[model samples]
Target: MVQDVTLVDGAGSGPAAARIPPAPLGRNRDFLLLWSGASMSFLANRVTTVAYPLIVLWHTGSPLAMSVVSTAALLPLLLVQLPAGALVDRWDRRRLMLVCELGRVAAVGSVALALAAGRVTVAHLAAVAFTEASLAVFYRLAERGAVRNIVHPAHLSTALSRNEARGRAAGLLGQPGGVLLQSAGRWVPFGFGVLGYLVSAVSLLLIRKDFQQERDPTAGRGRMAGEIAEGMRWLWRQRFLRAAFAYVAGTNVLFQMLALALILRVKEAGLPSATLAIVLGIGGVGGLCGALVGGWVQRRARQRTLLIAGAVAWAVLIGAMGFTREPVLLGALYAGTGFVGAVFNVAAAVYQVRTTPDALQGRVAAAAGLVGSGTNALGSFAGGLLLAAWGALPTVRAIAIAMAVLALLAAVAPDLKGELPDDGTDTDAVG
Candidate 1:
């Protein structure tokens, strides 16, 4: 028989806020280790992500092969997230992360070896991509949970902000790093991934703290489906979270479409590809800047205010992009949107982490991610169709209008009016 569980009441929990504060994040040794290792791994993943298609195209000269490998890499985000979340909650998270990193070393290393031996095949590439991505999913989920345990609750927002910035920085550098490395040799990026994963594994080994709170062994081990459901049910009960995630989903879709539209706009205007790259690079810098300030913003702004304001800001910026074609102007406008997005992500992550019980952290994070980003592919496909039918200008204007609608809804939504309570504590129980 399944045992009964009482999930932490996020809204009502207050004791978490009273916990003793830890050292500043800069001086926190474990956080630094976690950050450095994750930063390297994230950068390496970005490098390989860029290289995968380049290598596929260079070798096979087939768009289909490139698409197959790309799809394999993305498939894990859609497939592995939920089960991985469940397992992360059930397993030793640090060990799981170590295993993931080591697994990635082998998976990515195989590709490098194959490429060097001139034995690389589409099937082999697809398999390796899928394996590496799957491991990454697990590692990311575990790391999400692990971060809360290693830091004090008071610094959660600051810690997450730095992490967000690290990710943006990795993306900013990794694309160019991948292209540069690929120019030297197709196998070089994969070799980098192997090295990065090894460093990440070492970092995991050095972390001495437990990744999760003690579990009740007597609470009968539940089925994976039940565990996932428990997390979903908890999440669904929080009106603020539900509204926040819905807003996030809408904005995420709009951003995905906007990115594609930007590329098409550049091409249609007969601008050099370098112009587009520069605009995107500027936007990446904007995101990094926003992440750097996220903790300060979160400390001052109410959650409801931030969400509504960010949406409105996005509406204005995206609308402006629809009317402009000048490269500098376009880059500045896109940068504004990126800035808002990074800040919004940091705030949302802080809220989620501070309120979730340690045991449910992985599952909750996975559910939120799935809800927030599940429609990205659909958005990309719809953007392509819209651009094909109505051109870039019209499609972008339509998205701006949609964003405006989202903003208006957020402003009036009863559930989003007040601040969400955060006790800054982990509320875990077995069912």
Candidate 2:
């Protein structure tokens, strides 16, 4: 029931083109509700992400603890994701999302209680946060995978944009909240996170349609791991998608390396948490603009070229983060990097949504998610260690050089420069 759409120019002289059938629910109804709920969930999740680190720092003052939580949160993608994706395809996506939200609600609420009671241990909190994050990744996969079922394909660009917009909005809210909450009580944001999850679950319950297709009585699925491989196989056959996945996974290493370095450098420079918040907020604005512009750019440019440019920009901006200690300069760099990165993300999202087959999207997305996270995990771990070893400036410089080399190569991928096939061959390959 994905909404179908037409992308005619606003000017009448451009000519009218009929799009496919509209989304199952009109723009302002069920879809908006879903959108609002989803956006809030993102905001809440980010709040927890920021709050957790500060809480750990407050309790243990240990960089090692931050590393531990960061590792626990991300490594699940490498280890547990194949089965998670397979499970998503097997379950009712809507119900699964609802249940997943409730699980987060309980987990965060428990953490809040434990923190309030001074009963929280770094180990116990890590377990809660990690489990909650793993579930969150699953719900995100289900949401993206189910979008095609909830709305028509023609409208996919719009739906995806809306989702990105929500995330940006959440980023705006959460970035500041995350920093500010540390000043209040480390436990406060977790309470908000619990509320957000509960509200998101309520929103899921209010959705009106059957988003999942009823399974055929005769069709039997194999093991989750087998299904995961099936998804990966489909991805590999698409030369474009394979390249895209590799590019995304590759760039993430640089992205998080820079981010981790920024935190270390900024904290060392005695910058206020508010300053960091501003940097993140401005970056969120850049992301907002990118999301708005990405669709049009897609219509006009080659995906690989734009994607490569974005990667290069990510590298350069992040390198600049280390070279300058001025808060204003850093904020500007963060904003620019965020804007370009958002363009990259929106473009990639479009490619994935259009190319992947609906039935297999969950698994494909999950596998893709794993690829992205696993790469980021390495970078994050490396970033932490690199900071401990050589200080932030050198690590940032190294990431910059690495990303520049990768972007240079990506721009020349032969398949990226040509016209797409008539039957959406390129789309499927990249998806």
Best candidate, TM-score: 1
- List runs of model 1 lying over 4 Å from the truth: 1-21, 424-431
Winning candidate number (lDDT): 1
Cand. 2 TM to true fold: 0.82
lDDT of 1: 0.85
User: What is the lDDT of every predicted structure here?
Assistant: 0.85, 0.74
Query: What are the per-residue Cα lDDT tens digits for candidate 2 across 1-431?
Result: 22111222111111132233453435535566677788778888989877877888888999999879877776667777878887887778898899889889888888899988998888977998798888887888888876655555455566777677677777777867887885888678999999898888888888775555445644438866687888788877677778777878888887788788878777888888777766766777888887777666665666777778877887788778767888878888888887787767776777776666656678878878887877876888888898999988888888888888888878787645542421265443333
